[model samples]
Target: MRKKRALAGSGAALALGLAAGYPCLWRHACLTWGATAVEVHREMPGDALLPTAPLVTTRAVTVGAGPAEIWPWLVQMGPGRGGAYTYDWIENLMGLDMHSADRILPEFQDLGLGDTMRLGRNGPVMEVAGLDSGHALVFRSQDGAWVWSFGLYPSRHGTRLVSRNRIQPPDPSPLYRLFSLYVMEPGSLVMERRMLLGIKQRAEEPIAGR
Candidate 1:
């Protein structure tokens, strides 16, 4: 009886601890991960992709390659092409049907302004909004509600790949907005972090036959 009571007490304590710590965890995930204040505040070329003020997320990684080496991977990202370089199982569970590419495919590398990419069979998810070859690419949602941008800046060793996401959720009640913020903000961070790391790994890998 005593052992059972002790176990129950410990479980309750653990639950309380998690409940208390959740807000801090959520804030860290939403506001700052792999990003500095300077990177977050600096205006990126793709900022003009959206006209409205949005909840912005900025994350970055350093890759041991130049922008040119990294550009091909970004260009080929989508369903039925090079998949989003995140956890494919999780995306598949969400019905995204992602199959992340290991090698750059020549066919998918010619992306241009106004081109569309699908998330699944569910129609267009992102449209090329603006691009500067070997430097930056920005994609906006078909409805113009979200903007995701990738920018590569020359660093001392290689390149700094910065990703910025700006989101304007559809008009909803204040309560619903709050709920969406808590859910979507952290979710985006998790997926985007995986994507950044995936791109970094791919970019740093040696070129085949070279």
Candidate 2:
């Protein structure tokens, strides 16, 4: 009887701990996954991609390299190119066939407006909608439901890389909106954070012979 009571008490304590921790987890997810006030108000060049998307997410990171160095990585990102620069195993599980490159490839360096970049083997296709060379690149889905943009700005340290995604789900029902807020936001945060950090690491690496 004593052992049973102790086990019950421990289980109750564990449940209480989990219940107490849930709020912190939600708060962290909201702040990290959702756009900040500045990002929400700041006008992004890629805003034209969706024009009026109700859902927007902005994530930024400072890189220790100039915009020129970062531009190459952005331009060459895709399934058949330099890869998404995120977790290859996760992306491969989703059939992206990602193989991130460690060095710049010349053939993939010549991206231009209107070119189609494959996200995964069977994932959505994104067409280049806007290009500002070393400044920004914006891509829009063929259906016009999704727009993703990458911006580079000169900073005191080196460069600030900002990634913004605008998504207008085909179904704007409350259920879909709720799903996006609760599910998509957290998932996107995980993938995007990794991609941004990956870019930062690659951009900061010293160029061979330079």
Candidate 3:
């Protein structure tokens, strides 16, 4: 029992030590998750939404459908609309008031420039900075510190959905910068990766199956 305990303790300590020293590796993997080198460096449609970006990350996924078929899912995403195609239970636990929808909602399809999207029922909101049906949708935080861009491209298999984020928080504190580097980047990886997979799953489901 003593030997086993010592081994477990050593393993945990090693993992923590690696995490502390592995911030760059972790950030790199998260920044380029599910993306090719070309895709990671690709200049997406809404890149112009923000000027002088301090940080940027790009991720992507392939869907077995056309851009048109996958567009409705993007159009209706929000806290109270069709949800973010992410972990609703986790968001709700944080009082974000989100729920994933299984089908396209017609009411939310007419999204336009400057439309507001809430992260929670009563939380931070993002504005529609850019939109092009079946092509791209971009959202910017109210403070203009963050911009999220989603783009769809024709691919050999079907379509490639790419998500890019450009961040330049205005006057960020040292603590905030450290927290973002250590916590936000990795945390976003878990949530956003699941979101991409979720959208791919939904877009690929047959209409009859759905």
Candidate 4:
């Protein structure tokens, strides 16, 4: 009886804590997960594309490998190419046929400036707006309202893989923007956090014969 009461109290406290932190969870904390102050505020490669974007998120991870080791994984990311390195089931549920590859795909490695990566089977496409071999890659939506970039910087541990996104939302109404702050912000945290972890895991794997 005493243990049950203790557990119930603990649960209630947790619930109350979450409620109190909802605002921070919505955007403040979610937007900068795994990112240092410098990374969160620094200018990324594709910032000029959406200079005045209202919603911007900057996330980073320290991969135990060099940029060249992780560059292939980024090159092969998308719905059809090497998949987004995320929750494939959740993505596929939304009609995104994502099949994450376990190895580098030679065919998809030639992603170029004019290339477009379709979001899903019939989803809107994002065009490759910038690329700098093993250092940076940026993509933008056809309407020019969203920009996504990956910047690689060498670190003492290994490498700092930073992902930044800038978006000039299609609907800028107060309510809509607030809804994004609560819903979309947390959702992005879930997916993008997993993506950074996934890339880190793959990039740190040792070669078979080496």
The global C-alpha lDDT for each of the candidates, from Candidate 1 onward, is 0.83, 0.82, 0.87, 0.88
Backbone clash pairs for candidate 3 read: none
Across 20-58, the per-residue lDDT of candidate 1 in tens digits comes to 676676575565577768888888877876746557788
Query: Which 10 consecutive residues of model 1 have the lowest summed lDDT?
Result: 23-32
lDDT of 2 by residue, 1-210 (tens): 999999999999997786566446673544344344665567778797687887777888888899999999999998878998899998889888789998888999999889996667666889999999999999998888899998887879898888888888878798987677666776788889889999988988864333
Evaluated against the true structure, the overall lDDT of model 4 is 0.88
lDDT of 4 by residue, 37-144 (tens): 999988889999988887899999999899999999999899878988889898999898898887889999989998997787776689999999989999999988
Arranged by TM-score with the best first, the candidates are 3, 4, 1, 2
| Per-prediction TM-score | 0.85, 0.82, 0.89, 0.87
Error of 2 at 8 (Å): 9.9
Q: What is candidate 1's TM-score against the reference?
A: 0.85
Model 3 over residues 48-151: C-alpha lDDT tens digits? 87857988889999999999889999989888888988899988898877799988899999999999976765655799988898999999988778899999
Model 1 C-alpha RMSD vs. true structure (Å) is 2.8
**Steric collisions counted per model:** 0, 0, 0, 0
RMSD in Å for all candidates:
2.8, 3.9, 2.3, 3.5
Best model per lDDT: 4
